[model samples]
Target: MGVYDKMGKVTKATRSRAEEIVDYVASKGYKLTRIWGMGSSGSEHPTGRALDFMITGPGLGMVVGNLIASYLWKNRKRLGVKWVIWDEHIRSTSPGKSGRWEDYRGASKHEDHVHVFFGTGAYVAPPVAGGGGGSAVKVVDLSQLIEAAERDTDRKQGGTTPGAADDVKIVEAALKAEGLLSARYARDGSFGSLTVKAYSKWQESKAGGSYRGKDSDGIPGRKSLERLGKRNGFKVRS
Candidate 1:
């Protein structure tokens, strides 16, 4: 099976990275399932710069997850990874710095998948399977990488209060980021029925409840707002 076989629409750079990861995993004697690509969201996925590889069976363990995440983090520069989210932690290379794995409170929690986002204008040169003219390749052991990643501090979940027009706009942006709201929502810092409907849809989708339900109501409460803000990487303020 080819890497791009079932993968949806993504940019060439993202495809290149996905191909490399797929080949590497296969070479390590692992079976890869779905690799999702584009969706109608403000996230990198819609921009063709993100890919989600669903992990299953033995690959669902934290050790394996950390291994893959650590390998990508170690070679983020060459791999063009803007950030990586696996299990419930996130690591980003946008600021050219490395930090502890921070908690990611998205509805998915990415427990079933590994998400990778490529940096803007960054690309990973394709691997040469049998070519003889390349430099020595470093082999990263799964056990070693897992241990290293585990040593990092488990960062806390981040969020801010919501009580102003800016807060509403943040919520709107986050909803758009997750593909929950269409462009029609306008994100005009005004919370209208459209925003309520969109947010309620999102809530129902994540929490499996009705929009009018106490938990999924269109109102932007603390917990729901925090989840949306953290999931979409938005700055929520009071």
Candidate 2:
């Protein structure tokens, strides 16, 4: 089985995000590698919030005529996820900014995994300029985030506010970094109140590496992203 194939069970967020992503992919004639029917939403992308997808398949396009991987490749300017990692199938747009791509993962571990999720609110993100991988990778870890949500309803990750559509990657480059967690636990970057609580919890558990939380000012720094890049295995290039 592949990395994604081993995904124990799909979440509602991943499923919702995939629905929107697959629609656009179909235009390019690329087949979806995994149909995350049960995949729930996470902090990266909270429930009901759809987003671009991460490339889990071998390639976005290249098999046939319509298989021209150029669809995502050509529209690179609009999708930010590609700019951060450089994948075709796993594409995503900034939260709130519909149809606009920001690729915030940056040159971090998130560069490896695609975050098509919603809110969690709080995040720390990695420091890789132009890296869409922010501090919300934790959202993908549904189990951990779910526990945090029990305490708060809204996200604390600090983002464009609920139902705003403005997304924040809040990733670094890896999946293990707690700095990458999301309150709602998705990858779309919606950020809510609950996300904040999760981030604090993560901070308390950490030992060093200069822990920094989200700032509504919308300024992502470097030290904050250090672990972020390593998470996605992009530290070398980042």
Candidate 3:
């Protein structure tokens, strides 16, 4: 199935890694199906750290699986891959080496899919260099926006001050990173109606009961921004 459908079975860390792997492999021209599967009792699947990718289409076989698995092993540290099982064999980070392919012996023997597990404290991939045709900026940190907001707050208390355009740009960047807003949404540093709509939609998705009704009224308040930061793997202070 689609990656989104399986995301609820795994932690956000696992979902991010799976999305990256799916995108990387798809760019190389491989069709993937199903990411989350309930493994046997006590398996990593049940713990939300494991995913399975089923490969379909002709001319794809063990050699293809080997190539995919090898690529994952090569980038294990960066991807926080704990282990990978494919074509009846498995390699893991536990030994910090790619072990020889032994007989998997489990059901399906992983002959049709590649399974990956994330390690504790999995790493999140940073934005790609030259992404968005060199026009799209990287995700903005909430702290930077907070600092600017504080400045704007101070200016407002003293005298009539212009709106915080920079804050809007930062929030737009965050929204773009989370796929809540399109790049064309104009990171022009203005908290216009468009920003409000986008921010409100994002808040609705979180729907943690803490920010509802007027609190979810489209303003980029501290609580919503903090939640957004945490969801995107940023460390935010309490």
On TM-score, the candidate that comes out on top is 3
lDDT (10s digit) by residue, model 2, range 120-215: 332223333444754332223332222333332344443333322222333311222343342235444443443443344434334324345442
The order by descending lDDT is 3, 1, 2
Best-first order by TM-score: 3, 1, 2
TM-score of each: 0.48, 0.26, 0.54
> Candidate 1 residues 1-238, lDDT tens each?
5435556777755665676576567667776766778873436777888887767655545555566677778778777778888888888776654666788887778887788888766353432233587543222222322222232113222121222334455555556545555544533555565666667777776532334576666655545555554444442333
Local error of candidate 2 at residue 77 (angstroms):
24
- Cα lDDT, model 3, residue 161: 19
Once superposed on the true structure, which residue ranges of model 1 sit more than 4 Å away at CA? 1-6, 40-42, 57-64, 96-98, 126-238
RMSD of 1: 21.1
- Show model 3 residue runs off by greater than 4 Å: 1-8, 39-42, 57-64, 95-108, 126-238
Residues 118-175, model 3: lDDT tens digits: 7777344444345556433334445544444344334433221144464456566666
User: How well does candidate 2 score on lDDT at residue 141?
Assistant: 33
Q: Worst ten-residue run, lDDT, model 3? A: 152-161
